[model samples]
Target: MQIIVRAYEQSCAGVLVDEVTVEADVSKTGQQSTFSVALNTPDEDGDGYVAILGNGKGGTDCNDNKNQRGALMSPGNLEVCDTIDNNCNQQIDEGLDKKWYLDEDGDGVPRGPDFISRCSKPEGNYMEYPDGQQFDCRDTGADAAKMFPGNSEVCDGIDNDCNAVVDDGFPTLGETCNAECGGVRVCAADGLSVVCSQEPGRYYHPDRDGDGQGASGSLPTLKCGTEPADPGTVSNDDDCDDADPATCEGLAEVCDAIDNNCDGVVDNATPACGGTLKNVASHYVNLGGDDWKTVSVAANGSVWVAGHDGKLALRRPGAQKFESFSHYNSAPQAPTDGSPVLNNNNCGDHDWNVSWVNANGVVFLGGQTGWIGIHTGAANFTCVPGQMPTSQDAITGMIGFETGGVTTIYVGDTSGRLTRWRPSAPFAEQFTVVNNSDFAYYGLHALSPDFVLAVGNSVTGSVQKFVSYDIDSQNPVTPPTEHVANPNNISGNVRSVWMGSATSACAVGDNAAVWRWDGGTGWSKVVGPTGVTGRFSGVVMRNDTQTQLIGQCYIVGGDGTSRAKVHRLTPYGWAKPLDIQSATANVALNDLAITPTGEIWIAGEDGRVFHYPEP
Candidate 1:
């Protein structure tokens, strides 16, 4: 229920001096009510308002609940800016004479209205209408030497300009700094500034043999300066001996039975011991046409190159130049004279497109016409008889391995079919292992004689997803197991795969997508280099656990600008771009291989070749 209370007062002259009416709802306890409007009354117990009892003067009850002697209050009675509702208008220090001190030292700035409110400036350091020039943020009291704006900055370990930057003109004590010497810089123990000193985190090992290089293998030091010592040092542990500067990393592999280049291989430069790759020269072979597709280098120094128009070139051991051959003339045509012309299935002349060379000097070259030619010698190549089923033709990838004294070659086609061929005298057809309609195999790499990895795109998904298949020797006749790999949370077709071992492999493809295969984790994508998102057609990884060059992976392909790009992966991430040419030439590196003797060779379109380590 609602309740109303009215209060009235009259003056001695018989006039209505004060009148107030309040309305409220009765509380559930029946002892109090909540007032809707309270006028000029102070709630003492806060148990809802009682009434507005005036002093018999017009609006004289500034605080109705207070004693009658305390009700005489007005705005004109306040004399200073003290924190109090002196006029009973619920406002403190309203319309009072005051002065804003020039609080330069911030010591005189009042925290609240409880300050000395004077009409004129104070006698002691305080002024009126203050600005930043008069305010000192750091000032504490009068005894403290006054620091204010417009003061000249000097390196006396104080903010002279009031800018808050202390002693920024020189390096402060205990700060990490750099010096001209190869060693790192540390704040001196006794001095006021930093000095050149050694820190365990960063130490430099200098080359004393004057070889323009530094010895590695010493505990690494994080020196900030780029200047080298008297005989400089490099930032790696590849040096076999720091005392002998001539025995540093990347040295020439001479025939002195020593493991030069610190690769743990002795006398490996010659082709007899495996082959030594050279970056000193670029040999371009012209086939009177364009389009060079792929190249493969065997362990024994046999280089086999293949491309469009059924072109094949071979560079055998001790040969200075590549010998070119044409497969167009050998492809079987329609039997015009009933003499059994090649059933090329309309695949253009001698298009022996992809080539693979095994360790036994055996090469298998295939092309679009379902033709796979076997080459035992360096010069002659023989095409296997019979054509594949029309849907299982158009070879995309081929690899071979020898097991139980027999060499078996596996071929992957565009329709996701894998076929096995036994190169026994007549190259007999073994069996078709898999024919999955959901995925298209683009590349294959043999991890061992027992396992092979097939990589390509999964067409059944909403987006083309990069996937792989593991073909084991025990189940070579059945469909291989499939595994999907996606890099950067997106899917793209994988173009190539290189298996360093059964436990380690790397695959590359569209949008610079890179994935690594591990025996423990299956397959995982690698975060590519920043700012170089482009299609990658080639990748080679070298963990080299036995040598000094461990933990290095190399990737080569085209970038967003269509330029040939080379990136090396350290433990941190992809190193900076190692490219000199721009996109003008379209230098897309299609394939790359690292030789046993520490030589890197990369080739692509326009017959372009790049040798790394730039020796």
Candidate 2:
């Protein structure tokens, strides 16, 4: 109820100082029940409020005692948070109390203001918070238990603490670090650093070669799901050569001196390109009258040469001179190169007529009387021993292949005998009949063991004969296919033949005899320059394992008496190299071979060995 106390503010204790009339709530309990507004002049309770008694219109003091010492319960004091009404209001602690909602999650935090008003905690006396501390961010559902003050920051896509920030502690989270992978910097598991999930399946690496694999030890830099978000990344890491696209995992190793298949082996499948270029024009001249008839090259750059009647020579790798191994030479001569030639008189030197060196640096030799042997840098030659047919002439030519300890060789002779010889086989299976009266083979070669090409003139040197034998045939009497034509036949006998590939070959002979064979057709006769005539006995094609000699065909031979030269048998015709013609003015070069190191060794008459060093 409103109270109108007719008193002045300065003298409300006993006597009125000035005339005034005020109205306030004076209907408090024990508010001067029998006193009137005038009789309320007694300063009971000693508070500034006068009890509104009797009529209760002017009773303002809620408590007044006989001793007049009332202090807390009166209209003159401010309301406080006690059970008693301090301001003489009927309600207890009315204006100064608070309304507390329930912290149902019991995180010591409340949600909204829908609560019970009380001076103390109403239901549960949880810890008290200061003003403005009751608005919990998440005080209801499953997350309400943690939506309290000072909550630990976590990574559940929400703010657990009441800090006004979601997922706190990760200060830079949701920020763009490696934005290309994604737009958010995720909180790492350890909470020590941030992470971008799109980067590196920790498997998506850089594929610099565009191969399906990346370089070894490559860093992961892409996210992989469908096609990689980064186009240069791959799911694998098996690329040994990051710069070469063809040098990835599962590739067939090529002859490029690299681990093309990523198998930790470099060029293990194909042989590497070899041959040191001899840009300088100089040859060694040592033996006086030794003639070299055959030239064979090995992978280690060794040059093997043989001739009629046990003539043999060898130019070891890095040697500048040929070692004449023939016992026919009157005396062994010293070489001009600083390196010495070790004369290994293998098997006491018989009539070694032909030579062939496989890729493994194994040398096979053919000799007169149908003798065959092998020299593998051993102390002695391993000769296949057995008495052959008395009609077996000299071993004119031979070509062989080796796999492990096994060897397959085709040995040809001037007696028109082509025999199939294998390791430990004394008597070989003869592939051709003994036609000593008709056919005499000279040079022999094979692209593979399946096909063998033997070129020669007739028994009387009247006509050229080109024959290819199929060694794959089970019949030892397999018929020889003659690459022959009747009308425009090549006149000069084909002395030697070299096949560049199964499809291309060149046969060289005396009197400017030259013929090129195309697999599509038969051999075609070729003529040389008219005035400068020479016997072209050796033919070789260049192969670097990358490009094919740029279409260059080198034919080495010379006029029988003098005028040694190197002639180029081009697609058009033959052209003589005058510089080589002048280098060996009188000597006649007989055979030439290109070693694995790309060195071109030319064996000539008089033990004169000219070299075109690997370029």
On lDDT, the candidate that comes out on top is 2
Tens digits of per-residue lDDT, candidate 2, 59-136, equal 456576735335678765777887777776577777563666777788777776566766677756333455666467
RMSD of each: 28.3, 16.1
Error of 1 at 443 (Å): 1.5
Residue 135 of model 1 has an lDDT of: 46
Q: Measure candidate 1: CA RMSD.
A: 28.3
The backbone clash count of each candidate, in order, is: 14, 22
Candidate 2 residue 5 Cα shift, in angstroms, is 99
* Backbone clash tally (model 2): 22
**RMSD (CA, angstroms), candidate 2:** 16.1
Single out the weakest 10-residue window by summed lDDT for candidate 1: 338-347
Tell me the spans in candidate 1 whose CA falls farther than 4 Å from its real position. Answer: 1-284, 327-348, 377-386, 389-391, 425-428, 435-437, 460-475, 484-491, 520-522, 543-546, 558-562, 576-586, 609-615
